[model samples]
Target: MKVLLTYTSMTGRNEKIANYLADYLKEKGADVDLEEIIDTDAFGLTDYDAVIVESYTYHDGEVPDEAQDFYEDLADVDLERTKFAVLGSSSKKHIHFGRAVDYFTMQLNSSNGEQVSDSVKIDQDPDEDDFKRVRDLGDRVLKSLK
Candidate 1:
């Protein structure tokens, strides 16, 4: 399967998570493309069989400024043939923890992408269990291709 994994990170937490997921997916034999969210084109999603998005929620529950364009552009794209999953690392200290993950999940669904896994919201950094969930999420995305 051809998979695109796009992400944005400020404190490097999300970046670490993105890489871990990418490695996990690659080990499973998926042709994975990893890119920053700013470098990804929402319209280009049609080229991939699946997409996995990871992001850090900005202060007060906002998508990072750099990812705003790609987030908005999803509204214009149709991804009925693509499977998707979203996950993010954000401080649970914030009232709206990991809101960016929620936003991406909803937006992808709205754009007609099949959600292969439930969105994961991690607190601050990932713990062992968090990493396991991330792996399970990747596994689900890959399994969807069958």
Candidate 2:
């Protein structure tokens, strides 16, 4: 399946995690398209069989401005046939930790996209083990496609 992974990272932590995921998926033989949400002009959920939407926790449970554009770009895309999962990279100590994941999941589900896996919430200061878990998330999503 083709997997599109997009994310925004204010402090670069989420970007690192997104890259790790893309690498893992590629190594596993899945077709992967990884891009920073800020760098992409447009995207449609229908273009890929499955997608991984990710972001770092931003202000008070709000989606970052960069990702908002991409999400809005999805407006013209038919999502009912798409499967996706969300990943949130945040500091557990932050008041809004994991809020990005919650918001993204809600948006995707409300639009009729299938949720491929439970949202994966990574605490701040992710380590190698956390990286592995995040990579496994990609594997799990791929399995769901089968």
In candidate 2, stretches whose alpha carbon ends up further than 4 angstroms from where it belongs are 41-43, 73-77
* Candidate 1 local lDDT, 1-146, one digit each (tens): 99999999999998999999999999999999999999999999989999999999998899999999999999999997589999999998889998989999999999999999999999988999999999999999999998
Give the number of the best model, judged by TM-score. Answer: 1
Whole-model Cα lDDT of every candidate shown, in order? 0.94, 0.81
Q: What is the TM-score of each candidate against the true structure?
A: 0.98, 0.89
Error of 2 at 71 (Å): 2.9
Q: What's the lDDT for candidate 2?
A: 0.81
Q: Assess candidate 2 and give its TM-score to the true structure.
A: 0.89
lDDT of 2 at 53: 89
State residue 80's C-alpha deviation in candidate 1, in Å: 2.3
